[model samples]
Target: MPGCNNNSRLSAEEVQELKQICRYVRKMIINTVADAGCGHTGGSLSEVEILVGLYFRIMNIDPHNPSWQERDRFVLSKGHASPGYYSVLANRGYFYEGKLADFNAIDSMLQGHPCMVKTPGVDMSTGSLGQGLSAGIGMCLGRDKRGLDFKVYVLMGDGELQEGQIWEAAMYAGFHKLSGLIGIVDYNKVQLAGTVVETLDLEPLADKWKAFGWKVLECDGHDIGEVVDTIQKAKRMSESGPVVVIAKTIKGKGVSFMEGKFQWHAKAPSESERKLALEEIDSCVE
Candidate 1:
């Protein structure tokens, strides 16, 4: 609400506007991690546009009433990326901007991973790799049972797809035709240990989802316009089936040294590195 307007489709001007906001989110993410001295960097950076696209321009959410029943829900299955998550929420006015300074500190509400009980905008407390999609399925099914129509959006790391539970949930969602649920894979291709190909290949990824009965979509995760269009198309498919947007992204997207580097998966930038990263982000907007 603070940065972007809600829309199913965006004009060229709106897309550029969202891109600038996304760059800001990326800057905020690294700064938050640097201030805390520990946080996921690469994955958080890669998914900034995806998160910003959803929170700023797509989802029907209220910053003032985070518990509003009609509000769409979002689950960051890759929960270690709390720096990005917290920064986006703060920027969206769900909480005070100053709280990000306390991230990961002693007894801080903003933990290393998301805790729904403690965090104002977090819908589900998540950290375990393969559980978030299953939880999203449960949310969708429960909403259906209650006769509610709010959608549930879930973001997962490509590495996390190796978990069998994800496929299980996929199968279940497909069978039930839970079209109100949308899944986003941050297919940055690089994960904690190494490349996703070396770690666990999700290639033929869209085909796999198709086999599971999902209406598969793809996009450049960092491209705000394409991402928004894909989400809008997915939302328009309630009569079809569950949708999974395989968003291909570069890990550590905006910053030069960090981009595509697996070592930055969970490493915070040092003081000098932080300064350099911020400069890179600043130049992107300029």
Candidate 2:
């Protein structure tokens, strides 16, 4: 959506474009799950702005050359959010939009989880949760070893943080000063079962990252401008150590009926529900 000036600074028009893309991407996520009859609905919807903000404005990526060595790398640690990830990748021209209909099918490149071998733009195979950060840390370290310059971004679910491995990876990143690594927590608070706090609390979350030796930042994940600005801030300050942005987001962001509802976590909409969902997205003010 943003101009290819290749930096995070957003013009008014670019901000508007990113917002429009968010709406488009959200609708795509809804339709994708509705078509498939099953998918991670709520989290996918929740992550539209975060993914779009990175893909459209923040990261230096090339959809045409998905594996270009010089391109930036992005890892979707919370792989159940593949609907959002695939929607953005398809819309960004990593693959055909029509292919989204085949999502999660046995032979489709778009799978329930990201597979770097199957998906053109996916940088890592993720879905096990709490492991993406570890892979991302390796990627960042690899860049140093190869004398290459590129940033690694890992998107993890807030609930996924409950996995002990996440903290272990955080500790490694901090101890090694992996400044090129950027960690994004989709802090929607709602998980598959219940609210994150009600399940396993992550209060004092920012402090946890700071204590791990990271420069922690927080933002409204639904706001594209804030997402871009905060990510750019992370990049600018990353030399201090790795950075983590705890993005506060709504569980089901763009759709009124699904917003903040944990039951919608992995449910597809009925035909009537799909109609209502698309209408709701269309009704949004661009």
Candidate 3:
């Protein structure tokens, strides 16, 4: 809430710009994933709007000085979604856009999962599911110790919530009253193997978080305006402990063939598939 309370809503032009930016990020994801020949496609596509909303409009970060003392911290709990994370960081000027071409290469900075030591603007090195919230809590505590008001935002996958460590971290954050911390769950329904319902249902998800003393918020994950608005409300809740936004999104968002399918969860598009995906994303630009 440190830098989020004032002018939180986006103007019409800003909303359009954010949408275009997200589209571009999606394009980057498609290209990078296909070119790399191995990457998580569905989850990365699903989280485009959430990542764009945060990096471009929500979080107070300095791309040039990624390690600035006062910068807000972000933890990508669903680290397999590194394509989306890396694309957003590149578009945000954290690194040169050309570097994206080397994603997932033998010795590239943009590896399969996000690494703070390897990539700029990545606050936490996360690949294992459910550990990001714990890391985010630690970040908040460190900022508190330093008397810094910077907030911490953690992005997670709905399937990752099946991990017990996630629940432990949630309880810890809630009990400690980490008001400056926010958790976002990309509820895209599908996971690596199959749908979350078939794998392990987390029904009544909002209620579960509320039971843990977190302020639960819900929004359409792909809608930048709604996501930003929900984040604004989370920022406005004064000292009400930690907040979590359950964002409903579609896996493989922008591509007709991949949307809602689990096969794209970690497979790269073929040449034809990549062309089709790019065409669909280009249609969304205006």
Candidate 4:
């Protein structure tokens, strides 16, 4: 672990190091997208910090024991954001970092979306929208049945909330009082076609989750301290239902030209654009 200090817990310095890791993760994402010739860059970049916070700071996971009974489960509901997820997994020692160079190439383990069968650390194969929460709920229910203490965390794109199946899962989780489950919404507000408001507004989103009987929390996704603190708080809250963390974030956060732009949602950068994006992300490293 290049950034790992001796502590088992994430210290202030470690959090800072993780932030640097996120920067490199963003750079790797930019390079991969550039090579892939097509990808969901905006959403991927927007969720990088949150993924870093989870994989490095929050989640209790083991790369060596991926299927360990006590390991927490993470489901990437926004599967198109796999670039961020894969980058974090690689940095966390899930696989060889060199394999990242072959991202999206023919015969590569990294497809455009994450595949659990191909990827070492992926818990579930996901791409279809609105299904991850259900899978997470199943895991939580299974753990509860087995009397296990593990938790399940799922990340969903804000636009994915438009899918009716998500609400069904939410209703079930709340009704069953699945307290072991946590769902984080990446509220970047930009989807593939356009801004979420233009497609299907998820405004009053947190309230909807609360109404569904979840303990809801909101935070700035880019703030590592806030991300860690909120998730820890959510874990401690006494709730007979699921928890939802609404993470407000900017699409293409680190790159000025791509920030808040819908066009970058599913488009790859050209070589020139990739050079600029890499330089911009690199400037944030230190």
Of 2 and 3, the candidate ahead on TM-score is 2
**Whole-model Cα lDDT of every candidate shown, in order:** 0.88, 0.90, 0.90, 0.85
Assess the local accuracy of residue 187 in candidate 3 as a C-alpha lDDT between 0 and 100.
99
| Candidate 3 lDDT (Cα, 0 to 1) | 0.90
Q: How well does candidate 1 score on lDDT at residue 226? A: 85
On TM-score, the stronger of 2 and 4 is 2
> Across residues 76-108, which tens digit of lDDT does each residue of candidate 1 receive?
999988888988899888999889889998788
- Number of the top candidate by TM-score? 2
Score every model by TM-score. 0.96, 0.97, 0.96, 0.94
Per-candidate RMSD vs. true structure?
A: 1.8, 1.7, 1.9, 2.7
**Candidates, ranked, lDDT:** 2, 3, 1, 4
Give the clashing residue pairs of candidate 4, or none.
none
Residue 84's lDDT within candidate 2 is: 96
Ranking by TM-score: 2, 3, 1, 4
Model 2 Cα lDDT, one tens digit per residue, 82-191: 99999999988899999999999998899999999999999999999789999999998889899998888899999999999999999998988887889999999999
Model 4's number of clashes is 0
- Candidate 3 residue lDDT tens string, 143-234: 88989877889999999999999999999988877878899999999988999999999999999998988999999998899999887688
